[model samples]
Target: MTKISTTQTQDMHSALTQAIRSEPSLIGGHEKSLKGDAGDGSTVVVSAEEIQLMGIAQPWDWKPDPVGQITMEKFQFCDLEPAKDSGKYFSPGGQSFSSGYRDFLALLSPDFQPQSILSAVKTTNQPPTSGASKSGWLNVLNNAGQLEQKPSYSTSESPEGWIAQVSTQNTEHKLTLEFESGDVSVATSSKEVSVPPDQVYKIQITATAWQRIQIFPGTWYNQAIITIAKARESQYLAGGMAQVAFGPGGLINSRVSEFVVAMMPSAVVTMDEQFASSQQIQASDIQQVKVGGFHFSKGSPESAAKLQPQSVFQSASAGSGKTTISASETHATHPYILAVIIQKFG
Candidate 1:
């Protein structure tokens, strides 16, 4: 093992002291550009409401609803298996796992799972294997352009005493940490304090989750955006769609009504992003796909007059996802499977 001289250790500590000073509050709102980190030139926007959780710190007494807190060790499954019979949560014409449904279950498959050199997940200030770079680098954007699920570790560490936080529009948990001290010192070394407040809480993502899940069942599970929809047609009868709540258009939401599906739930359902107020993973229920006025038809997208163009995917629909279909495609499967695209009503 290579040994670090006392001088090098002190230098590392001194650097951490200079790097981790408190950042100015982005109270009302803030917008960060990822033109550099994510190369694709996307942007993260924060409205005043969102900034309360993102830039600004929440009050000590803030307690969210539903008595939320779940542990992955005890957390049950998402019912990945197809509903064996025509019953609750199962649409009439849905297909079975054999008909293209195995693709999703493959997330947990060891033989096919992708291997990423992820840091050993820890809830405490256990130093990462290396400390040459900055420590508090949380909310990291994956180069693969997909929200990959990190291995969740169970812990009961409280969220109190957190001095700094890094929240994002992508991942479920907002990383929070109470530094060992305000300044790094030579005596203790930098390893302890350099790791920013981090926790491996339960994760949840938005529309992107349906795009491409990178969990390695055994292989490096990666599917480019172009071929994500390849298995759409074979999943019919397995893609749930019976008795889903409806709307005016063939789909209550026309912006999202097309593309292939063979087997799935009653509709192209959308799961809510996970928010763990506590250190434990909380239970979640099936969510409805929320839709909105922001239309990206034939390539036109919702715009900010003077803002930088931050949209990444060049599409309105037609990608991965078993039950989901684009507006045109949703109609083709209509009356067959209800395209209950939930509306994210403002």
Candidate 2:
């Protein structure tokens, strides 16, 4: 079984970056919900309750394995077989399989046992801080005491009262969010669509950038909404499913139902406007779409299938349909993630 060694992290990220640029179909019209990302330098520790809650709320839905089985707490990917599958990447060939978030910790460090993590784990949800904004988006202060609403798809959300919320951060309008369907023109789109986050996958990330984008603290864990602008000509970002996750423990964000605003605003993010404008994405616009949370496999789907969508967010896989070494597939289309700026941190 091939596992993702930390050494391969950079290599994998580089491969994905290049792959997406070369393959448009890989990204296309995927990435539905813009799951909030962790701001640069922001770190949120995953709690034990969150992990347990997922286990009880959403456990692994596979039946007798292709190799062995392990209860996965979060939605993780492996181009070959989604971590949920008793397939490849994990304890294969019927090797010793353990459950819980410990699986991830194990990957990070085999010596870090589940028992140790179980004891050390604690549910500590902190309140807003002096430097943070509860709004989940960037909260920049201006001379007007409020940010003027940019001409865009997102409605005018006053940053005045939100200044005291659990928060921080801000955005641009010429947004390009392509999903698996492969529509390359998100910059000019004008329609609004509601799509399941799982159904639409994203690959908007770079090796250096993804490293800095952490999961929002006590993050929504579920998917959130995204507003793209359509006013001007923006450079083509990334372009394929390779931006998603290939190996297990790859970067996976929240999962939920998102209300997409195809109203491209044609906005721009200059260094000056970085901390100046506050295009707040109201919480009302976001919700959990997947039936059993992110781990939702095909069972939740009407077809009663598994390893199809939902829980599976991958482009380069190994075992699901392909065999032997590894395989690559696409379910994305456009790129909008940043390299240095913490674009969305909810």
Query: On residues 1-346, what C-alpha lDDT tens digit does candidate 1 reach at each position?
Result: 0111121112212321222122222111222222222345654221111100001111112122112222221111111122222221222123211112223322222322122311111111232243222222112223565322322212121122111211123433211121221221110111111111121111111121111001111111122110121212122212332011011111111111111111111111111112122211111221111111111111221223211112221112122321111111111111111111111100
Lowest summed lDDT window (length 10), candidate 1? 46-55
- Tens-digit lDDT track for model 2 on 22-41? 33432233322322223345
- State residue 10's C-alpha deviation in candidate 2, in Å: 24
Query: Candidate 1 — what's its lDDT?
Result: 0.18
lDDT of 2: 0.20
Q: Report the number of the highest-TM-score candidate.
A: 2
lDDT, candidates in the order shown = 0.18, 0.20
